[model samples]
Target: MKKHFLPLILSFLLFACGNPKETNNEKLTIVTTTSMIADVAKNIGKDSVSVTALMGPGVDPHLYKATQGDLSRLQGADIILYNGLHLEGKMGEVFEKLARIKTVVPVSKGVDPTFLLSDPVFTGSIDPHIWFDVSIWSATIKEVLAIMIETDPDNEAFYEKNAIAYAQELTDLHEWVTNEIASIPYNQRILITAHDAFSYFGRAYGIEVRGLQGISTLSEFGLKDRVDLVNFIVEKQIKAVFVETSVSEKNIKAIIEGCQQKGHNVVIGGRLYSDAMGAEGTAEGTYIGMVKANVNIIVNALK
Candidate 1:
């Protein structure tokens, strides 16, 4: 079916399933585009909301296309939250269609423009990976809180309390990441990865970052880009290049081999959670835990 038919199909499904508002006897249902957003919503909404993430562990949101099941979940939800800033690049049309009938909010909307990073390759576009910086991600928590409170006014106090507690944890996480990344020798504080997902992390933690691909993993790097990156790695004697959990390891592997060809041996550093988090029930599963995991990996490899 044509992509524009999503809303029409969703409408038919909703009609067949009965009105969600009149049914849905459980807590408020929230459907988020990424696991990171789901984690934040769950923390803020707590027991007051039932949350589900369309993308799972190691799923790249940039190229993700919503399946028919996802449409149903989204259509049935009381709130639909996404990273926005074109993070869910392929699902924009679906979101636009759903917005007409229900509450579909971009959690990034509340973030100050001054705090956003520009996409170098795409002029007039902002990088969508704001969650890499714990401080910036904390802003999204407030956005989720505001929407939840607005949608369920009776639980305003409850949502506010949860947001306050989550905010403090994020504050502590930001400090911890800063100190840990600082431990890496200043010159050795470079993070090379498959794609440019960690620019916010590097900015927040004082590390220099390079990626083979552009901000989006879907953006390809040509032979010249690879050669240049290899030359830089060899010249700087960079210890390692990391792979992303969500992106292919092929690009990083190519970088490592290119360095070796020039007699500069570089190993694959531990994989980092870029666009996605770890599986559910794991330490890296939650937003804070994922940040800590990445910090520990970078510090251990680069320090």
Candidate 2:
């Protein structure tokens, strides 16, 4: 079905939708790939732009495909913001077609390539989970700020003020995460999750990290991978391993069972928000809130 949707996007591209920016009274319609990007856009574009996210809570962007309605929304949007670096792995063609006709911004564009972590399994590709590190994620806010201001210069001052405040909030969050993770003794700061999404988090906060699957959930893990992970858990005597909200728990459960067979009682720490944020209107729905929730979960479980 998704293979068929790309051709439909080409057709949608042929028709010109009404440009909301041309009118003075209407607000700009912003469509985002993930809720994390939508939350930031909403905070900065507040009351000035109408923002909508195509992928909601628990939706894995790695495997997510655009729908007919999503194509319609993408066609109608004034600007489209997405986390590039192949995070939205299945929607590359959709973004390419949309880019020719509208303002499509990849928030990760502002991140310094030198600072990016390369994928160990997939050569030449970098990790897309920049949001795990609050400081690094601020780079994305800058990208959004620049794009919003470029598209709507009239609100340049407003956007600048909002971006500054948002940046400071993230700075504080980064500090808090550093201090919180420190509480869990250095030797015990091992964060094992369902996938390699938290490599940035571990690097930024001084914790060792491991994942059953590779960087992207789309990658598969075989029996040997599971056996090695179970052996590592038993050897390290690690307390708990976490499952991601956007990923399947079957893998983690199997790891726990494997640990049990070796007399190591490993528990599921908590469901951490990895590829996606929590449901809308909840604390974890927002990026900052999601970070705080994850930090708290990790600290409580490990400490």
Candidate 3:
């Protein structure tokens, strides 16, 4: 048992090393856990700061374990940002250690609890995937703005301007999502994915969401869970079920097979960016782009 926990313990111990190495450059060295946060930093910081994401596209934050290289990047980072509420469960120790000496922050820190969805499996833990709902993500933008300005006070004016512009973009995105969802016929608005990451998305958009596993992918999917989900999807005659970019498609395949066993046909709607975003350089790689792509896929499949 000790051997099994040794890796995470070793990683956390690395934070006790001296202060993060100075880049000796003008840019504010920012390291983020997810691509969404990295994109926001880039958008707000622009050319003023250098932003890096430890988990790239198709990477699931729930199960992400730090490598030696990742620990090096975190230690050398001037500022580190992550989604709180234990989203990065494996890195909790390291984040706590870094908080003692560095300005490590969680993007969800500024979000109002009234707007947050509590994780059913984890007591007192809120779902950290706020980017799905553009309205909720605006709160995260504010958090990013505050930190960026705090880290680089000299460029306060520029950061504020960029932040305001980005806020408006989120407003537009929120409206766009609402409009897109409204266009889909009433009962067909259900969003079924491999995991329960989209509860926030469903709550914000007024769609019903269900998943085989719990909110976190770390939870197991059993034979009973499979049968129940198949029954739900079949009972609703849900036209399509979706898979996630970060999670394995095996659960989805099993669900389809179960449905087939009962003689109901279900096709995979399309892959949605859940825990992670699309590959960088593509439209879905960016936060806004990821949301739009997901909405398009959902609407196309069920409509």
Model 1 pairs whose backbones collide: none
Q: What local lDDT score does residue 134 receive in model 3, on the 0 to 100 scale?
A: 76
Tens digits of lDDT, candidate 3, 32-143: 9999999888887788788999999999999999999998999989899999888899999999998999999999887778778888877887787787777777777678
Distance from true location, Cα of 27 in model 3, Å? 0.6
By lDDT: ranked, best first: 2, 1, 3
TM per model? 0.91, 0.92, 0.90
Candidate 1, residues 137-190, lDDT tens digits: the string is 777876787788788866666676667677767777877888899899999999
Tell me the spans in candidate 1 whose CA falls farther than 4 Å from its real position: 1-25
Model 2 lDDT, residue 222, Cα: 95
The candidate with the higher TM-score, 2 or 3, is 2
Q: How many residue pairs clash in model 2?
A: 0
**Which candidate has the top score in lDDT?**
2
Count of backbone collisions in candidate 1: 0
